[model samples]
Target: MKQLVKFTTGIILLLTASINGFSQDLHFSQFFNSPLTTNPANTGFIPDGNYRLGVNYRDQWSSIPVPYKTMSAFGDAQLFRDQLTYGWVGIGAVILRDVAGAGNLTSTKGYASIAYHQLMGNSSLLSLGFNAGSANKRVDVTKLVFGDQWNGKFFDAQVPTAEPMASSSANYFDLQVGMNYAYFPTDDIYINAGASVQHVNMPRETFYDGDNRVPRRYIGFLNASLKMSDKVILNPGAYYTRQAHTSQTMFGMNAAYNLSGDGNQQAYGGIYYRTNDAAMFMVGYQLSSVKLMFSYDATTSSLSAANSSRGAYEIGIIYTGLYKNRAFSDAIRSTFCPSF
Candidate 1:
């Protein structure tokens, strides 16, 4: 039994590494709320925030036997800020976990980040940021089926599988850096853009004794908000990422309605199209500093035949407000650029 467990674990680990080396990282439909995962520069960025906290959950590919599940939690704080004078400094920490596959492969990651912002104009700024972390991956072999168990059209546990295994788990250090720019032309307009490079050091990530490095990933994104009237606002954005030979692109727009013309209590809905993959529908509500969001994907690709177009469902919640900085009266009303 021990030998069988080791053999199955080895094969699962090998496959996981091969897939991870080329595919982009796990993603969330409400990517905007999970700021730190997208870019380090997003940490502690709110209009005039003292601190921000967020939690996210995702359930993907329910059509399959074993679904992919993820959960994340993070917090960020403003270490220093200077109205429109000397820019600012911020710091944050994040932890997330994901589990998938018939073998129940699991991954856990934790990271800390810091960023510095430089004033560009009266209403514009540029930010540079860095993060360091560790990722650990493991697998359970009890649920796996071995091909060698098949003998003359029937499975036989007495037969020797003869599979060799080196290890069943591994951990690797990870690093990323990013740059972001934001411009608030008026009370009604906001524009922001950024780029990031992940796995820059390409540390070893294989479970086996051999050396295998995590591939480098490049990401780019932009977002904007336009106020059309006292009750209506428009938000549009796009995000693109590439890892080794695999790439993904997603674009969409959101229509938001202000309930009392103050822009504090709001509701929004949108459709996002994933290139050659699926169309995602999202809806959310925001009251003052708290937001609750939900989304579901309608598969449109070749996989639709197997799953009847049902994909993933996701949920996100966040809270952002001032815990300090009581000096500036207008600070809370400031229009700042968050990664969202």
Candidate 2:
């Protein structure tokens, strides 16, 4: 049993390194909550409010000895709604941090984003946006145990692993751009779609000596909000992303039921599937301007055996508000979208 545990630990460490060093990017089961990380065009795409703020936290692989953790905070707001004749501007910023594995590899990123939204007609809207950011990754090499350190029966830390490690940290700049389109046929139905490209610069990102550039990541998503009745709303969404040779696809649906009748209080629940990876379940609540959500991912892949099907859990909180002194008479109001 001891040997089996060691083997599992080693495999998890390798997987962590591969995830951080290769094609896969950090992700969350609650993708919709992390709007800025999903696409830059979502920076200021609030449909029911003038400003928004959100935070997300995730812990993964807790069944293992070492767990991976990620966190993010973001805020965005719409501007010039009273001055612009046909369009408005949006500006926002996001900060993200992650720590992984026994080596305690840490990554931090920050971005500033802007977008422009134009009203095409009474029922349609168009948006375009871009973001620029910087990222830094560092790891503690001493805590890592190499294969060469094994001495038949056990591993020896005193043994020097003949590996040429050039540096302990790396930094790079990143850029992304995206566009969104929304159509509301009536006051009860809304449809939206968007696509974005990340790592537009393909900047170098490696601790070693060679030129290892980050691959361009392409993402696309579609979602709809349907009001079934005055007391219920249904939301269905699909997402797809590709980076280098790897890709991910997800499909999900969420339902909101009004508890206060006036839409000030609501209960939310949803289920999602990530291709062949995992199945996620979510529960949430909204009170006035604040919404809180919790989700859990259950492993469905081959790795489930090592972790007993326990994958990850996440928490998300969001707040939306309007300017107290601003007049809503001339503002473009989206009665079809969810208000929180």
Candidate 3:
């Protein structure tokens, strides 16, 4: 039974990689927390603070013999806030790592991003940004068993598998560009929309000797924040992305309730649905300058049968703060953005 499970898992991984021509890019169910990965234009688009830092972790397919794990860390800050008369520059960096399957196929990526945000009157803002990164993927070929290795009754490691074995690693450079627009009708209401394109350079990524290039991924998102009262705020958002022949769409709403009345403490809860995929439940809390969030994905697709609906779980931690010398009132007075 153990051998069968491992074999089945290996086959599934092989099929998925073959279909995509490479391993699928790592993503988090709490897409909103990983802003830099979602859109380069979000770099330093901080509304509530001058600078922000965050980290995220995800574990998937725990029911399988070998699970997939992913983690990321990122930080961004607004620059030239006092130097630029009409616009300010934002800079940020992010690092991501992922490992999958018994073969230990691992991927690591790092990116540096920058964006310029211009105030359009007192109610609107516009941003344009880009990022450059390096991606590397490696797998332990020795640990993987090919179909030809099967010896009828049981797989024999001693038997030679005549596969077109290439190098066990691949590396490439990646690029992305994005734009954002925001409108704040009043302090109580804010709306934002953005679109981005990943793999703008169509970098080649392959382990074999053939010429295969990563396809461009297009993403668009819209979100809004409405402050219903001093004690409550509502946030609703939608995200869509397409890469090659596959696409995904997700929509959800989360609300924050002020527990301290002074906005220093709050509680958050929400639900999100991924079309034909999974339903995500989220809960979070905020204290002063830090926020912690947790989410779980319950599989709704056919794959649920194998895993018994045990999908994935994720955790996110974010911190936002102003410079020690900077006055809170001054920061609020300089921008016309909504507070969440």
Candidate 4:
């Protein structure tokens, strides 16, 4: 336990140190792992035969800088079943880009996973999942320029110039393990809790010096949904993430209300605040089988003074597919769908 604490502390320090130097690090969407882009455990959280498709876009500090933009699209569905317990498998990918005053970088990661769910009780399930993937990080050196005052100085060698600058890319494998516990006593109420660790082996980041490895990360989340009436449901969720010496926590609540007489459509609104990060507001809508979500963040930290009210924006979508009818759906349905 002491070793673990020490390790965790070291990682958090590194993360904070890095962030302080850059003024801002690559910002993950405020929703973070909820959309399944950051955690493997979420890959097959929805019922069998149900598919999840989502996209998130964020533009930060639009007022004080060129704006840091990040976007990700991911889709996952369960596949296969086991005799004693239900089993699921899924795959997804995400791409992120960052542009700052003197540097521009882009990264993409792809993942595939298999999960096993066991019935813990009459109304609860415990799932264990494993994910494997590769990430590519690249930087554009030519787009960088340094002051001429550094001419003939050692620092000049480290500085990049405008001649189509130099560029470097690195590919590294990533692994994540996660577990989730969910219980539903009634269709109208449910609770979910989960934890996941990313960058299992601490993949080396060749994009920087010393082949610095990306530090491992630990994330935990809890979400609950309560049906208030035939037309409305309230969902509250909390997320905590730690990397290097820094920790971030987000807490928020959202309400989804059914629209239309048939209940085939719905709309949701919510707000969230990340510790020392940003305050955000979001809305979403579901039309037939497609669900779309959007969010905007407001900077509240000291940096806000320089950046203004401009914050971040995110958009996501989810599509539900009928499993019993489609061939691929039928295959997975027969394997993972619970009989009970």
Candidate 5:
């Protein structure tokens, strides 16, 4: 476990050194479940509902001794439930944490989202949204020993390595903005498109100082849901992101089919491909108001050379509640609404 942590930590630092910026962020294969991270416009944007709460977790690089772990929990509430024509106001909050490597390099983030959704038509809605958050990163430098600390023929933990650092921890405020268009032409046909800019504040994040900070992340995504029949639904989506000189594009679809005659139970599966990254597979089952999903990714990029195609594993859980207004219909609904 110790060796694995050291190796991954070194890899991240080396990558950032090459880019000349303390860069790179965490993500998951199960993107759909991570509504806030994907787009702030999704805040409280639940169709046929007034509130929603969900959580997601990921464990990656288990092929190694020390694995990376991430988890998040979020909640959303939409107001103006009775007046469909006047539109609605949605608000949400999310908190997340990630830990990796032996240094226990940890990142903690909390964000609030606010959006104004204007009713465009009986079945369409347009939303403008914004998100504000604080991100804190911390590391125990003592856990790592640089080569400079090594003697001529051996390594000594007591030796002092001549390295300069401003601090072992950093905290920064981040801002993000987004817009989305959702069209529910019919109960069976639903589509949405959105764009967002994350880290708009560009707060400094380097432990060594200077202007190096969180770079603005630009993202664009589109998704559609088609109910092919009473028993089956097809969902397709594409996502694109750019930051600094690095960019990633992912595209895929999931097909869900009712397993029971009443359409209350479903079994679904899908595959997604991340350009130059890895291929991901997801499988899930929905029972009433609760849905649980699992996804895994295998490296398809050059990084596979060392890890032998090993990648990440993720899990997600979601629950949605129905609102009094029936202006928009959700293709599927979960019966479990927990009040905790």
Candidate 6:
């Protein structure tokens, strides 16, 4: 058992170094800035819809033992009108679980945001948003074991070490700011650009053996949609991120076919590819007040040899116009509760 654990740890370390000279961290998607996860500035940016809901999941390095997996769920909505301008608020929660070698780590975070949107010109709008929240992290010491000091005992047994006395958990505060600009030069085309920074205070956490701190992250994205015809459109997008001493840039283009529908609703199918990541295919359908989408990612790296092309899967859903087309469900309730 000791030898097996040691081998597993070594293999994981080697794989991590091979990928980017460090272990992989939790990331929502290669498609980061879709008015969902990237920036608070995107909250309630959708037209006519007062609310939205979304969820995403990721699985990585299946070839290795104890592969990494992540899941996230989020929602946002518009609040009310102030004269010609509008005010909106959003809330999101994320849970991350990482399994590498003999250790397991988990992080749970919740955030709330407020945003204001105002018409800029004849065909443009400007949005500014701010977010504040708290994050909690926990590490179960019993789950981690050193290769040389294991005797097949498990579950609350004395580890013969005094460093980590009990299961450790801590909470910290975080802040974020963002801005977005959107333009619709024509009735059939739209373009948007945005930038966001998270963890402005650089929260410090001591949940692990080393100095485990939540690093400040920056993200930027650009998106454009072009109408090819009455029944087709092309949506191209790019997302860039820098976090924890690592930087990545992803660019992808997707073409969506507008299936026949009525009254501000449609269905679409798209294919996209990203640099240094995977090729993705997506299909989505929108009806009356609900939208659903599914996507599959295919590995395109040398690690493809191990997983044999299977990579990640994601599903998302959104609903709008619940509260008399004025505000979101939670926002409406909160207006009365006044304490949540």
lDDT of each: 0.78, 0.87, 0.86, 0.65, 0.79, 0.63
Off by over 4 Å in 6: 1-10, 13-25, 30-36, 85-102, 147-167, 208-212, 261-265, 322-340
Worst lDDT 10-window in candidate 3: 326-335
The residue pairs that clash in candidate 5, if any, are 288-334, 288-335, 289-334, 289-335
Distance (Å) between predicted and true CA of 115, model 2? 0.6
Ranking by lDDT: 2, 3, 5, 1, 4, 6
Cα displacement (angstroms), candidate 4, residue 273, comes to: 1.0
**Residue 332 displacement in candidate 4 (angstroms):** 16
Model 1 residue 252 CA deviation in Å: 0.3
Q: TM-score for candidate 3, please give it.
A: 0.93
Error of 4 at 151 (Å): 5.9
- Tens-place lDDT per residue, model 2, 1-340, is 9769756764775585477546567888888888888888887788778899999999998877778899999999989877777678999999999998878989999999999988887788899999999999999999987789999989787899976779989999999999999888777888999999999999998878999998999999999999899888998999999999888999999999999989999999999999978999999999999999999999897667667778899999999887767644354563438532
After superposing candidate 2 on the true structure, give the runs of residues whose Cα lies further than 4 Å from its correct spot: 2-21, 328-331, 334-340
- Per-model C-alpha RMSD: 5.7, 2.2, 2.7, 8.8, 4.8, 7.3
Candidate 1 colliding pairs = none
Residue lDDT tens for model 3, 75-174 = 9999887777667899999999999877898999999999999888777889999999999999998888888989899877778988786889999999
Task: Give lDDT tens digits, candidate 5, residues 234-270.
Answer: 9899999888878889999998888886766889899
Residue pairs in clash, model 4: 11-244, 11-245, 12-244, 12-245, 12-246, 13-244, 13-245, 81-335, 142-164, 142-165
User: What TM-score should be assigned to candidate 2?
Assistant: 0.94
Model 2 collision count: 0
CA shift of 170, model 2, Å = 0.4
Model 1, residue 213: distance off in Å is: 0.9
Q: Estimate each model's TM-score.
A: 0.88, 0.94, 0.93, 0.79, 0.88, 0.77
Model 3 pairs in collision:
none
Q: What residue runs in model 5 are displaced by over 4 Å at the alpha carbon? A: 1-21, 152-155, 324-340
lDDT value, candidate 2, whole model: 0.87
lDDT of 6 at 13: 53
Deviation from truth (RMSD, Å), model 2: 2.2
